[model samples]
Target chain A: MGDLTPEVQRIAGNLLSQGQVDLVLGWAKAPSNGQSVPACIRQAEQAGRLIFDQYCIHNLATGLLDHRDSSERIGIFVKGCDSRGIVRLAEDGQFPRERLYIVGICCPGMKDQAACDRAASGLFGETAGDSELAGKCRQCAHPNPVIYDELLGDQQPPFLNDVRFSDVQRIEAMGIGERGEFFSQIFSKCIRCYACRNICVACNCRQCIFDETRPQWVGRSTSAADNMMYHAFRAMHVAGRCVECGECERVCPAGLPLMLLNRKLIKDIDQLFGPYEAGLSLEEGARPPLSSYRVEDPDPFVR
Target chain B: MKSFAKSAITVVLDRLAEQTRTYVPMRDGVTSNFSPWSERRASDLALNSLNTTFSPKGIVFPQTERLYDFAVDGQRADISGTHAETGENILFGARACDRKAFAALDQVFLRRGYVDTNYKARRDGLTVIGRDCLQPGPFCFCDSMGVDPMGADGADVLLHETTEEFGWEPLTEKGQALTLRLNDLLTEKELIRPESAGCRLEVNVAGLPEKLRGMFDSPVWDELSTFCMNCGVCTYICPVCHCFDIQVMNNGSSGCRFRCWDSCMYPEYNLMAGGHNPREGKRDRFRNRFLHKLEFFQERYGSFGCSGCGRCLVTCPHSLNMVLVINRLGEVKVDAS
Candidate 1:
């Protein structure tokens, strides 16, 4: 990772100098804590601020939405999961592929900044060490980017313990009432901060349902019912489109088991839609299972 | 000095809980916050942690609260204020920074010739028991914000943590009353007051308010807000970022007006009735937040809006925080127009 920074800087500098990109999105060491945070470099000289490290865990794909309304060509760096975000956005027609210069990194997993923060804050009684890999990275099936104009680093294998749907299976094994109780307990802790929704690349709606005031699709209260509605609506909306980046779970301040909900939907989609994974490619006119209808599609819920 | 042994601290809390709904710093799953204490949650008490993940401000000003109830039938309207009397409550083991935030909140909801009935009701009954922050973390900068880690300005009772016992000092009439209630549990003892150790992270806020007053149009806001994703995590988790929106939920004719936490970072925060937004861009919203914390708050109140508990430092997914903003703002050369 240390050796790859020079190449990243060189490529970003070259892109900016040649005016091939209006902006380069990557990670830079935060001056406050020395932790790698998202950096937007518009000038070739500022490209040196960029760095790639294990602590650069934030999914920069969500940041692309800030420029969606503009015609500025963006040069972005992506990990395996983040590349899926590009696919998610491009497929949704929210962003055009022509406006992007994709720089992909063959991710080797990253450490969780929250864990490092908790440990450093001395707030949690005992927290995971800074060196611990993020829980999301542990379940990653793709360590290499699916799409990129130019790639960095060597490709890597899937993480050791790929129990992607194991947690979903455990929840599925629970009885109906117990599962309801489990979900309610977790949902009750939600503060309605919307960090999970805001951080998700798949949530690219011009006007989110939760924010609609005219119809008020979801109640704003942090009550059990409202929280459930918020999460359930969000999960259903992003069911087949979610790239399994595990970012929603990672950014949740309440520590809710959001991946359980997301992975459960993914597993169901795979079963019903016959082995499908989202954000895997940029096929022309291809749509997620939930987005496009098929004549042979199962309609178990419709009946 | 009246003191209680560290082992008997729970006994003190047990007695306090009998009198009022006691809120204590407790671990909740992956995070810690002030929650109503019970025997079952006694094991989760995190007195020695740097600061709770969430601030204890919700004890007085909740995240959501009903302002009024209204019913409209046949062109006749019946409206009732939902100003229920908040019963006695105790906030135990709050640090100086959090306690200072209560003072900042007090200025907004209680002072300036206008009073919020709901905030006043809850605040009047609330007794704050501020504990000394002996273990300042890497992110803490309360001292830089003019807060003393050893002294809590508005706390009724101050609990000084030592190796074996807590040296309790009653500072107000309310503190005295609580001291009398726990007389049996406490014993007179002489203990060394812990040395006040300030935070490792320090920012010079001197002349910051004055400098920020005229720098609203500074280009620094653009650079600072470049990577900010405009999430509500910082404001919602902040102890003193007390912005809210009043909304109503109507089921046909009967509805209740409620207020919930709102963030300036959101696009809808500044949306006007005419469908025009003043602070429409991320840079505008971001600049307003930093100014409010540094300049506007000081002009409106006497002190800074931020208590510097550094909650945003840890929780912001993008790493955009007050410390970074302050440092960048201080470094930039601006004309004091």
Candidate 2:
């Protein structure tokens, strides 16, 4: 991919200049030094402010939820993984596919610059090299978007060496007892911050079930069992549908291996279901497997 | 139906290995659970053991599954993608209650608004080998839910244990194929039916929809709510609870997003961003839980949401059983016209 700044500017300017889209959504530097965040550029003049690099990690789909009923067509920039969120929203029938223009970039996996800084120092190390990107980026195969109306750079081949579940393999190598202990220790660190949930695009719910007071399923206490239930149940809810974008783990302040839990589900989904992707297509009327039922489905419980 | 002695069942497991991944109950250290068959060892299998510590739902609705991934700089999102390793596996030694529980889950996760292809693929590719429950645990209550312990309603291959012989009945084409593949170890024998295990808990959920509607304001919920610490163990261990939340994470310019499970018991479950909780207290929360399972599910899916597996009885720190609560609710005499 070309320098992210120029590529973002060129794409945004073209979409705006040609009147193909009413607005261009990209990333611009946050007020903090070199920290980039999602931004909406309504005019060609603002395109120069756009920046794309390791700092542009937010799944901008959350921002689009407000625009679902709008009549104007909008152009949005996205990395390969971020496109899955849009695909999911489209699949859910949350938005009209034709109203949006996609400026897909061939991403070369961005880093969790914050985490690298934290590792370098007790708080968040400031001296860590830019090369010390997030683990998700290091293992990313399709850093480039699978679906895009306009491409910003040369299409790179998918990474063949990426092993999706290497972390899961490490955890599975331990004996059952050891594995339990390891998970319990990691789970104990969860303070129920819901940061992982807040940062997840797939977790978009009008009212999260965890917050439902009627049944009182999970308690307010941050005990071991409660924490375990919170994390485990949350992971199960998104099984088979998770795109493995690794945003949940990145926003986690406690640095829990939240991605491992998601990857484990992805692994199981692949193991049980045929190879499936979250959102690489615009085909309407296609259904997800978990939502449909067959009367003859194999039931192991009946005897 | 063909009958064989208990000893002959081991030969069936051995023969099953020739074709597919055969799973049987085995002792892993001190605990006994169903796992993939290792060597051809009869002692490794634990056929009559208690329900596995983890529910068999993982075989269908796995924990920590991916819904999909997408990236968005702003208004546009793209979702077309595929993951590696979607294959097939077999689950052996699933119990009757767990089987019935899947039937209920199938209604929620599969039969609901959006068809989850991930779940459907696993449901399609997997074969369930069920064993009849001769003994019911203290917490077992399948009979109360109108499920027959010995009935082969859900099993692909149903196994019946008898003193003189073990009977294998194929309820579906997949089961028939599996039986045919293992036909080498079988000898044609007469069918011998076993007696049914009587229902352990008696629950009249027939009028529960009306009964619960009138009983919503009843003080009975307050009594049940007192014991609940809101631990969420019951929902986690439950095979049918399917509520969830979606979120997005960003660090600078690039980030991934996801969805995870959520429970109704938490205070934050219904709390909006402005610190407003719709179901404010334990009483309201308690009522909504039962209403969703009994009334809402019936209203939407035409059946009670719960399958009566009784995992909540075993896992609850307070011993608040749903059966006992429902029974008490049933006893609340409301005036009829």
Candidate 3:
């Protein structure tokens, strides 16, 4: 992908200098030339640091929640998936909509950091279908921001794939015992590092269930049992709220196929609740599928 | 000195496993980790992997370890401390960076004024086999961190790999004993090791810890923390981060106390029992994590806590690792100086 540094920096500098926003949230070149990390440009002078490239894999919207209570307006740069995350948070009323100045990017796709490293190519070595882009990006439906104030580049055409949930289906096709083994093995790799939970924008609870001491829902231990419960509970919690950003799976150090569980819920949410997609718009998401349901909604467990 | 053919290392490991448990870098789905030798373990031994996703420290200091078990009967209460295992652990194929990390860990758990007996026993019982990392990973900066990828200071035995053979050099009594046990498999050969190709990334750590003393109020931490996803990957992957949380796991009037790896990046790590949390913001937690690795640990251990394994560089969601912190802080320091 071509570097959009000049335009991104110029726009961010304009916003910062014009006093239009208290902070301009973006990505900057990390010490590793191939990688770009999230950057928060509070001053106009620092806007030169902002850059947009394939290495900007982190969903910057999750970082924006830290500034939710602040009254000052903040300028945030968001890709398609990241824009959906912003809408997820906005639906929960964590960050006020008026305070957010969204600078949306027409994302092609962000490449996987590990794959990029293995490619051994210094920069812009995103080989197509070599598993370079994150699985979410690979199965990406929307490359254009769903919600934004101002657009950066021309809108990207819809990039949805016919086999978006093919991988999820493979898991669904497995027997109950086989699925249990698959997930059991996935949780075995978990170190209880909380990378999956921390990177997720859907996990916005002030006090997490994992941290509770008296009840101790999820032990701090990395035991397979603990890991399994932690993931199962988290999957249900983000059921209707998740925007399929895939940031949770992308951020996991253990390489857990978290989206499989999520995609299953998403499919069920669509199948039973009659076609629901969370975070499509900025407004408080249409009551959600599980939270507000019709009597006619299918109950697979019952029948 | 003894040598074994590269292809025959598994046969050697199988023989070694008969005496004691042998650990090698094994593939787990996508990532590689130093796990106990098993039928499921890849025979290739993941030597091609630059660095394992988790450090070898887990072999010595497991993520979750029971200190003691407590039992409450109908009338009486019983408490029992865990006994140290008899059979020793032979950790083979550790990279020089990991060996250096063990040296750093030695200062924390062995030579410190208050030595932890549990860590000491585990340290004493285990034998480390260091491997020369001929080709450093894309993100490896062990050279910049003053670590030679070919050096084996902490390892009991050193092994250098080539296309044909693995040159084994024993450095300690434990390694000598193991060598003698494997004498049938090993043959006397000239010690020829490969020269490291060096690291792709270079981080200047000269006078870094001292320079970091005055950087308490620096704005760089804010910038770095903005991108930091606040995950424990860096700390867990780090070879020498020894911070742990002690907890009691109770089951129906019976309980067991164990300690698990704790990351400063976590909100709960520094949080007190009271309602107030001092390091509530990600910036403060992130700053503390780096400061501990760069400044605090250096002050206490007289060496930086990082080994430049680059596991964190690859694993971190935002690519936020020690190299990034060191380079960025170094840049700021140079600008100020």
**Candidate order by decreasing lDDT:** 1, 3, 2
lDDT of 2: 0.67
Q: Which scores better on DockQ, 1 or 3?
A: 1
Query: TM-score of model 1 relative to the true fold?
Result: 0.97
DockQ of 2: 0.02
List each candidate's DockQ score.
0.68, 0.02, 0.43
Worst ten-residue run, lDDT, model 1 chain A?
Answer: A122-131
Candidate 2 chain B has its poorest 10 consecutive residues by lDDT at: B247-256
C-alpha RMSD of candidate 2: 23.6
Once model 1 is optimally superposed onto the true structure by TM-score, how far is the C-alpha of residue B10 displaced, in angstroms?
1.2
What is the Å distance of residue A230 in model 2 from its true position? 9.4
lDDT of 3: 0.80
> Once superposed on the true structure, which residue ranges of model 2 sit more than 4 Å away at CA?
A1-303, B3-5, B8-35, B39-45, B69-80, B83-86, B247-259, B273-275, B335-337
TM-score of chain A of 1: 0.97
TM-score: model 2, chain A = 0.88
lDDT of each: 0.89, 0.67, 0.80
Give the per-residue lDDT digits (tens) of candidate 2, residues B19-119.
Answer: 66666766543233456675645565666565654466755665444455556667776654633125656677677777887787788768878876777
Per-residue accuracy of model 1 over B169-206 as CA lDDT, tens digit each: 99999999999999988899998988866788999899
- Flag the better candidate by DockQ, 2 or 3: 3
DockQ of 1: 0.68
TM-scores, all candidates, are 0.97, 0.51, 0.93
Candidate maximizing DockQ: 1
Q: What fraction of the true interface does each of the listed models get right, in terms of native contacts kept?
A: 0.63, 0.03, 0.44
Weakest lDDT window of 10 consecutive positions for candidate 3 chain A: A119-128
